[model samples]
Target: MATLLYGPQHDPIHIEDRALAHLKIVIATKLRRNETFTLSWKHPEAEPGGRSTIWIHPSIPLRFVFDEPEAPQINVRWVEELMHTANSSGGIMLVDEVLDIGEIERQH
Candidate 1:
């Protein structure tokens, strides 16, 4: 699992390393453009066991920490899908990569 630390107080958002790798790309792209988006995800069991959303912006501090030393394989399809959602007014929603990341070698 990987943790996305967005703010100072909120607990880290835990996600699979493969997904986080892809997300890093999507997020960096947006931030590079000075675009802000909301990232929403269902909390892990260790968290509140519900859903959470965080406003992501270029000015805000953020970090991505992976358990593995090296980055995992990134699915281009997943990045496109995530970028699509991030462009929407509703913002980026974390979905199962296996369902959308077609034709890419899944890092499982």
Candidate 2:
């Protein structure tokens, strides 16, 4: 598990570590470009039965904490999918990663 600590209030939004890793890349890229967007995700089974969305801005304080000692291998295709939605008016929607078999083959 990983926690996304957003803003000064430090409201903790829990997410799976793998998802968080991909999100971190997309979020950082947008913020670096001075772009703002919203991130939406459904609540995990452990949390209440609802979805949550947050406005991500360049100036806001954001942090990603992972329980794993090392970062997981990133999925470029997943990041591209996220970047596509991040640019949309509806903003980024958190979705499960679609394994890229081609990418894995290229890596090996």
Model 2 agreement with the true structure over 1-108: per-residue lDDT tens digits: 899999999999999999999999999999999999999999999998999999999889999999998999888889999999999999999988866778669879
lDDT of 1 by residue, 1-108 (tens): 998887767567798888889889999999999999999988767766689888898877799999999877676777889999999999999877745443534534
Question: In model 2, how large is the Cα lDDT of residue 18?
Answer: 94
Question: Candidate 1 local accuracy as lDDT?
Answer: 0.84
How far is 65's C-alpha from truth in model 2 (Å)?
Answer: 0.7
Best by TM-score: 2
Top lDDT model:
2
| Least accurate 10 contiguous residues by lDDT in model 2 | 98-107
Model 2 residue-pair collision total: 0
TM-score, candidate number 1: 0.84
